[model samples]
Target chain A: MKNFFVIIVLCLFISLQAFAGLHVVTTTTELAAIATEMGGVHAEVKSLIKGSQDPHYIEPKPSYASILNKADLFIAMGLSLEIGWVPSLLTQSRNAKIQRGHEGFIEPYQGIRILEIPSGVVDRSGGDIHPEGNPHYLMDPRNGVIVAKNIAQKMAELDPAHGDSYQKNYEIFAETMNHKIGEWQRVLSKHRGLKVVTHHQTFSYFADWLGVRVLDRIENKPGIPPSPGHMVDLIKLIKKESVPLVLLENYYDPKPSQKLAGETGVKVLTLPVSVNGVETVTTYAGLFDYIVTQIVGAQ
Target chain B: MFTARLMVVLFCLCLLFSPTLVLAKKKIPDQSSEGQVLLWKFNQTGNKALIPDISLIGIVSGAYFRDDPATVQWPNPTRTGFNLQAAELGIQSVVDPYIRADVFIHMLEDGLEVEEAFITTLTLPLNLQIRAGKFRARLGRENTQHLDQKHFADYSRLRRYFLGNEGLTDLGAELSVLLPVSWFSELSFDFMQGRNDVSFDSPRKQDFLYVGHWANSFNLTTNLTMQVGVSGAFGNNVTVRKLTQIYAGDLYLRWRPHERRGFKWETEYYYRSLEGAVATAKEGGVTTSMVYQFARRFEAGARFDAIGFPEDAFSQYQVSPILTFVATEFFRLRGQYNFLHTDGAGKKQHEAFLQLMFNMGPHGAHSF
Candidate 1:
């Protein structure tokens, strides 16, 4: 019993190891990348998920609570994108600061216009629709500017001592992105009216931004696997529309898309949808560069 | 009888495969040229209605079993027909920044009973959490879970013998600490007001019994995880002597790959010794359960149970096979077959069970 008490006290002391800066936990690698750019030396950022995995499905793990317990701020793409995992982790973290309604929790898509919000009664029948809106808004680089600003402001509030530093870093990130966006727009300018197809609905924001026409999705619904009938219809639509590219992400199985490509003879382009999704796309800026280059090269 | 059973199996197989044919022509969502849909913006101003996260879980199970030679065990659900098993209405909310409250009401044939009502401290110092209210005794790994939360529809013979019909739940307070060791380890100590007949008969007794548990889990690989734990509880029994004690050990191994169905294997062993009350002797048992998620929404599992009563030199063994279908995220159906045999003057019994479980409202994912 004496030794037990000793272990408990020692554990508590280790858990309380104070950090010199704000500690941030983001739901995805892209958000963590944005936070890191804005936070710089003033904060520490950790993402709950890796870049290659699908954000739609995350298995709950105890290590999530262990890391979340130490977070001074939490950032996530709301709109039910993280509905499967983050809510449970917040409840078990035991850190009141990161819970909902707390100042430390930040939803990056608060002011952005969300896409794919259903017009009528929505359920799984519509194929895994987000009750709020489509949460894959980060595909648009302009939204990355908004995400970075939010992180900077949140970090400033939590650690006022470095508020000025965070803002300076935010300004630099915004300017860099502003220049890159113009270049990206020029690259995609010629392909505005071209019809595109994808394995999932994740390209909504990207297609909307570039004015590219997304004709069809291989999967009938969000979580459901594509049926033979659905696949037949999709192939017909792609062939009829002359869609040059059928995009797929790394997180999903490529066999279905490969089959679609084989049947329709349309070129398939697998893009790294998130930061660190591929070795080359290590940063947020590189994500856009890789995606745009792939789309253009495929054409 | 063989033809009759084969007919049932064929019918079930048809029922199962027919859904796949329907899925091939499922409801395909229409394309929206304008994909933007923005609704009311969520404000942090607290203007929105505070809705308590409420959930209702209902389980209806029916079973058929042939009588064993000596006698059926306690609360084993021996009736070989359909029955309205149980339902639970649960309400939970964060009471304040300092605590959260969870309450569950079990609806039974008699009326409604408070299954568990507890408040957990959210903001305690030193990685410490305090839970105060009535909870299942953390004696064995499975004993802490309520009936509706189980993977199997029917209770095993060991659990039926040790935990009784309702399982060993008591009014209790628990304090758990996240240990500082490198991995995921939690140590919890519980003190509870004993229950009637199983351990102590008086609800008014102020003498609190003690139960302790230590659980540690680690990822064996990226997809596999192994968790091991030990539990001990001591109190008074109405049997013969004045004291009753239980010691338990449990292990769970699961392999859950990303974006795929997984498998889980669980084993628990327990030893209970009664002193000076009814029988001043020791009894022991072991239960092992395994589940393989072979399809997207279907799983098959089996359990083996062996238990020895303190009063008798004979022992009982049972084997059960269960097939389950998750119709949706909130609803499930299971069919189970069990074979029970006894050693030393006990007859064999064959049983079958069918169960349906459904849930409504918000219930967050449980701990791993």
Candidate 2:
């Protein structure tokens, strides 16, 4: 049994050595998809958490460390989106190459203007608050442009041999994203000022960009379960606002949203906010395509 | 004493409730002339030197059960009253470029003791990791986890029969080698002081206990994963009056669909292959548990335990149903009921418990 494992490890190493592309590991599926689009042939990207998983609640696994150990570049949403799991992976991987603020490290929240950052002293009572701005910035297509550009620049920095190719790939991604943003805007234009209740705080960025009014969240805080009092309050507000829709994501329990929808006869729409969040949604553009299409069609 | 205990409990509740209650119920304000809503991000630099990622986890439990107090065997006994399960304080930080430190101390009613204190070398070549101080030895699945991390209120029947209150931890170090495989795989070899509360250590023989573990997890698909491992340990038993050997196998299967709610089934089996002179003969048992997350923050699980009842003629079998409610990542409340029946004497026992756990401060990620 021991020799069998050694042979397996040797085989895997040989197979891995065959690929010379730069190894880039990100903390989220949305980032991984964007890295792939921008890195093109120059990089190989692996995300620590699948799109289906909540980035804030990622369970740390030993295998994550091994994948990070070999990474040439590491990407995170920053603002502690991956705080639950990523830091421990970096510590356990012992990979000096991808430590925070290092050349091999890239954080994408730099260019995207952020919101919901508490003005005064922040505490957990704020409901699993992100001391940084909202890390769910990817829900907005415009922010995807920033992520793409950052990923490509980081790739070029780490693998300078293919710097020009990365630069060219990034320009294409940026142009494509800007065009898609215009198209998505047109599709979602009718839903402007539509009132909706979200399951978590994550959809705030999406609502902010699309002119949707976020009436309330089933979970008042990021990770806190909705207290009965809170839910009753939300139901009252939704009735008062006459909110037409209740928005839920693939990673949240639908019961709370369903109960809310049931209370006021409001329509419930479940959407995947990120790539790989659903099996049908597999790319950066596909994420927006699925979400906007669902919202517009449901209306 | 009652007043002091009540005060302590109130203090713990305050610590648990303050985060949400203390904050002003302010809206995500409308965009102002500043362009974005709010500009206050976490001061990244301020956290570097002083904070050091420290966390304190406290678990308070009260239970009532129908078991003879004198013959109590479990740590969280089936006593007909309240007990403090454990209070664990964990401090972790990266010491330098080459090493990091993790320390966990248990504050019990009797005294305070270091649960685990170890410095790990992270920069070793060949994917090798080394820890020089006492750690929760990477021997088996249940043996490695802390008390609060468990799904059930008590240890499994096998663990209770073999290992007592403190699991299989000794003042020794472990060296782990990460296999360079596509899947997650690790092999660990530990050499610890041949001293355990279970008398699995030879008090007279100046020797060390050896434990070996090989574990790996594989993603079957996007929503499903399976982890399996085999572990073995060899040591001298002073009370058993003979050299002792133990072998164990564990399997964990999980199906999580898009991170919302999921199902998990885990089982472990162990065999005390060698017999001790004064102790009972060969004993073996298996524990199997299945849990389903029916709703967010809510989970229901059932565990079946059957273990050889040493020093007696009967083998004990128990079925426990547990309901867990996670109020936050930091706070959890659980209710559990256990029904136990013996084979020979046919003695039946019933136990019920309410356990509350709260964690304050920042904690490093734990092994999944």
Candidate 3:
């Protein structure tokens, strides 16, 4: 009986070591960054997409399959953002543990405010538009706080042994974001209700948060490249709105945007949408810093 | 009698539990407790008349086989065989917000053989999706659908000679993904084990069986809204002692210089090399097609295809015109006429078809 008890104690020790922490896999660098902060040393977080790469397009490498094949939790920006590769990878990776509807598949946006919900039918002809609205909600600092809180809550639920640590990390992130929000409000205070035009619909949430006025979009529609006729009309619209800036994401084709900017004599602000969008912007703080500096500098 | 017995059993069960479900529905008004069931209907009809020779007017029913449409006679429709081509049944609803699955089964009688029975998976995200069981191989754009579903009938001679008159399908799995660059592009990769659609279960040399191999293809349809992609596959036929390497690509552009009225121009080119005594050397081909759709309901298109084969004395070219009419949302009809010319020698083949198309609920492959 004593020997059996000893064996049981040893098994418990081994299981504790084995279950030391959960293995979490996030689809994008943004989620990975936040998860790293929340999980701290208790969990190992791996992001499938490089920070500089667009989260929308990930060439699923063999390594991703291997990671997904063993993940304890899978997190992503849903709303069809990762619609391109997430589903098939789940199936091909044969990781039923984190497949959709499984407790481990965390969309993260479940309770957050969703912007741009389309009221009518959406089709491909509309140019790569998301019917659910602009999914780049993480751009606004307020949304960032909500996302971090949710991530912390999820981490705590998933790892109650280290729940306190997760909560402490969440507080740190939330405090940091709240302070930055004040700084951003001051920086953006001058640009409130500032009229602007964008190359795409990427900045809807950012503009909403900053109280910036969007006169029109350069693409005419979300995914379609603006036609020559559309460009001519936009030039007129920009002049009419007296838009001061034509904002473009770093990765978009700049030819049309530049041409329109030149035609309207509006400053073209090429903003980095995410941390490490370029080699220069590599952290969450850096992402906000870059956007603020650029918009301020451009104005 | 067995079906009647089963129906009676189901009826009694419904009677016993129908009220309970109603009570549940009232209690959980959003219908979350009752769950959700969706239904859809679709069909298509049209006419085919070629000048100076052959023409026919017919209607094919069942785009998606919900219930079997009465079969139509053949030869009288198209010498190739059965006409009233497709009927389908589809159902899909989210088990919950995070989980959803759809099932589609199609039934078709080609007068010669029962042609279609298949299922597809449409719920993969990030453009990554896998289709298993039985479905069409992603060969050529035209080969992927039924005639009425196609912008035209009378596929290229190369498609006929190599892929066969019917498109390929068998027990297999396919994976597709979209690169997130905002470039509007997609890659569909497939791996399947199936014989050619033409000759089923035919015996061949070990090299031929080996050559009847698995294919890995990369298909990229650009977001220019034009589809321009190149895909290649290597095949090994152990029974016939032959290895085949094939590369094919198509450039497709749908330009609506004007909305509601537009022109679609598509060109497909292929190069195939089969390593064997009889199949040595390289064979290359190209097919260019142009279509004009009027009022979003009527379509007129034509294509020119050319190919070179060793067994043949020389290269061959075939030109054909395609016409289609949309009768309703779920139903469409189409017709085609082909003119084959081999090194100045010409022969004409005309064919017509009627197809009922039921688009049903949206079950779509991951868009690039």
Candidate 4:
């Protein structure tokens, strides 16, 4: 029986070679880039979330299921960032490797620090909210590096023949990121003390890293839309302070930010919070550089 | 034969055409945080093929025994030979950061050998929805495709009769939104109008009818969910007003000490006031069912339902015992025995049934 099993496995391996190159599926473009950077030529990576689309409200397209069905590995920013959509999508993949609890189901947060861990039971009372703090851990460069390493390790395990190549590529990528981080820090330091207002509380990590003071959010509550009274209060507060720029995400409807900026005489600078925020900012490094250039240029 | 072949051809076309629609433009999270896409579903491969988030399809098929073979129950059970119980396909995709659309197509028994189809789209941004075609109303949980997706093989007999298997589906439109509430609970209200399924004494062949349904649910710390809802419909026909007050409510709770396998208890009560129609009086019924899946691949369950019509002297009851075996990840074998007892009719009946279920893909997620 053991010999028979070995023969079947050998036949399967021969059939698998026809389907060689590793297929990587990711939930977001940022993670896709990391997998590509780590896997190099050994794997082809695809992102489920398009940079121009909302990560939270992605409708599982039939096309995504087809991609996942054949993919060898799946990576995501876990902690419910893709919560409402991922679970149902993954169930369609039928690949045991990419299923939850499998090594292929890689969550980069396993090695990084998590922020905004809610102390109480977090429900959807405040709109469709994630109970597990914020799932946007990728905003921080350090978290990005850690996630890249996780992807590299998983790729090495799946393809041992290319394990050495993956490690070398990861090391080079880390060193290159380290050098760029220093330059970004220097550029951001000049605007460290600047006070900024944002539409939502999505810039907690970026603000912490730059030491920028978040005066007030344009949104009245976490998920609540800005009311007339709240906007009036925000306008009063902005005029009272020496604020220069009001930060707004690229995906947000700019009318509200523009209206508030117009009232307070504040410049509404639409910033890319993640990769693909603009055609030029297509990678993680490009995203940070774009944000830094905008903030410092405003000065 | 042509229609059957047509359905198969459409299903295959959907499967083949899906792959060509690729994500050409690089996805930027910012562009999608606020979106305006209509409807979508992601299909994977194998039994898990499709978006895991909120997509589901179910079917229910059974035999109905009548007292007199001469008098046919207009819609209850006319003729049966492996009928197309239900054909539902839906997609609840998040289009942007803050918006998602819940859309579905329901094709079920409309009239004599007739199948109906409709689509419903629920948008979250404005707490409103735009519906087109035929869809089930929010009258009661059982009225919707609730029993069809059950882990057990049988449902309460009361649900089968008054709720009419396909429960309140017609060519119409409805708008509903969940309201903000305190604690772990949610509230929602619905109002709809169009082609109603309930028959009335209307001289006009087709008349616009109004329907209203309200639902509230609470979740406790002990992994228990309790929901209550009330629904009513009104038609313009002078005689139809007599059948206006149709109300129903259901309570369901499932306790899972462990995920994938657990125990569930469900109950439902239905009341219909048909002024001078068949048994033209008031009729109410209640059903209670208990299910337990203690081990992987095995399950055992039972149910008891009783009904009381104003014209009838005593209530009718039904008890069912269900057993299911999961032989593989994609298939399940279920067998059930239904014991029917009617006080007025001296006939005590029993039916033994077997059902083979092949899940097409990933099971859709239920709303929390």
Best by lDDT: 2
Model 2 Cα lDDT, one tens digit per residue, B1-368? 34334434644553344322222243333535332212223446664645677889988878877765455443464467777777888999877545688999888767788889988765555666667677876656888888877888888876776666677877876677777777778888877787875637676656567788999888888668888999998777875447778788999888877455889898988777555565546777788999998877799999998887233343888999999998788899999999988776555888898999999888777777
Model 3 chain B — which ten-residue stretch has the worst lDDT?
A: B35-44
In order, the interface RMSDs are 10.0, 8.6, 14.2, 21.4
Give me the candidate number with maximum DockQ: 2
Task: Give candidate 1 regions above 4 Å deviation.
Answer: A1-19, A253-255, B1-48, B67-78, B108-110, B146-149, B199-204, B239-241, B276-279, B309-314
| Sort by TM-score, top down from the best | 2, 1, 3, 4
lDDT of each: 0.77, 0.77, 0.60, 0.61
lDDT, candidate 3, A30-120, per-residue tens: 7787788888898888887666556664544433655675577788877778765776566544454576654467767644577876657
Model 2, span A15-36: residue lDDT tens: 3645688988988889899999
lDDT order, best first, reads 2, 1, 4, 3
Q: Identify the runs in model 2 with alpha carbons over 4 angstroms from their true place.
A: A1-13, A61-63, A91-96, A99-103, A119-121, A182-192, A296-299, B1-42, B47-49, B71-75, B239-242, B258-260, B273-281, B309-314, B341-347
User: Tens digit of lDDT per residue, candidate 4, span B97-213?
Assistant: 222344555445663322233333211222233344455666666656543356555445676655454455665545443332222222233333434434323545544555666
Candidate 3: docking tier: incorrect
| Candidate 4 or 2, higher TM-score | 2
Cα lDDT of model 1 by residue, A1-299, tens digit: 99999997787557553667888999999999999999897788889878987888787777777788888898888877886688767766766667765657878774577788777876556766676778899999999998788778778767888889998999999999999999999999998877888888888899999998888887768777788898889888888887888889877768778988899898888888999989888789989999999888888
- Residue-level lDDT tens digits of model 4 in A1-299: 99999987676433332446789999988888788889888998888766655575454543355466557888878766776577655543334446554446677675456666665655434444545566777777877887777788778777879988988988988998889889988878767878988887678777776788889988656545577898888888888887888998776557678888789789998887767867898888888888888888887
Candidate 1: what lDDT?
0.77
Ten contiguous residues minimizing lDDT sum, candidate 2 chain B: B33-42
Winner by TM-score between candidate 3 and candidate 2: 2
